[model samples]
Target: MIKVLGDSHDKEMYDLLVEVTDLRKFVEEELHVLWKDVDEVRVECQSRHASNGNASISTSYIVVGTHGIKVPKPNMYNNTRNATMVENFLFGLEQYYEALGIVDDGAKIANASNFLHESTQLW
Candidate 1:
């Protein structure tokens, strides 16, 4: 990975890829998770690159085309950084994940970071 993606943001993906000793186990246990996780990371980077900092949409709801179906966006978590709030956030986040058809733990974990505020990111 270093040779291929040298001096780039490839550390996490490289680590996951390099630790796979068994091909069959990799396919069964790691392949899909890795792909989804990497894809999530790439999508995040691409969005940041495209936006160049101002990434939040102006509106909290998205309107689908002609039908005018409006769906509320998922809530950003960690306003107060309390345990109860975190639990509520997780519950709401899991529901959001379900609505988006995101079932894998890797993708869920990846998505969680995007919703966390700076105050709770380190915590």
Candidate 2:
């Protein structure tokens, strides 16, 4: 499920936080990203309006496995493109890992460091 909380007065751009209880299901259905052993996914997006009326947005995605946290690069921009960017980023991530021959192993992937190192090259 997706949960959102923010100040009622700030409608221009409020924080959008989405949490998927069953990440595997969500990934397969919504993202179409194949993964067999992910347990949870949390996405947090925040937008702030500066005094000059300019807005800045940032998004972070956290994938939780039984063993550790998988951190993806945070996206930052000055426009309104949270949802699309997040989806695209995740899709790319899935593809990256797949290309590296890394599949979800119920958090049993012992060489997670290798995967993490390779992911950094994507940036």
What is the C-alpha lDDT profile of model 2 across 1-123, one tens digit per residue?
Answer: 123344453443433222344565676675544332232231112222123232212122223333443545323222334798657655665554454444444222332233333345344
- The Cα error of candidate 1 at residue 84, in Å, is 2.3
Which candidate should be chosen as best, given lDDT against the real structure?
A: 1
Question: Residue 20 in candidate 1 has what lDDT?
Answer: 61
Worst 10 residues of 1 by lDDT: 57-66
In candidate 1, how many clashes are counted?
0
Cα-based TM-score, every candidate: 0.39, 0.23
Give all candidates' CA lDDT scores: 0.65, 0.39
**Per-residue lDDT of 13-35 in model 1, one digit per residue for the tens?**
67667676456676877778988
**Model 2: colliding residue pairs:** none
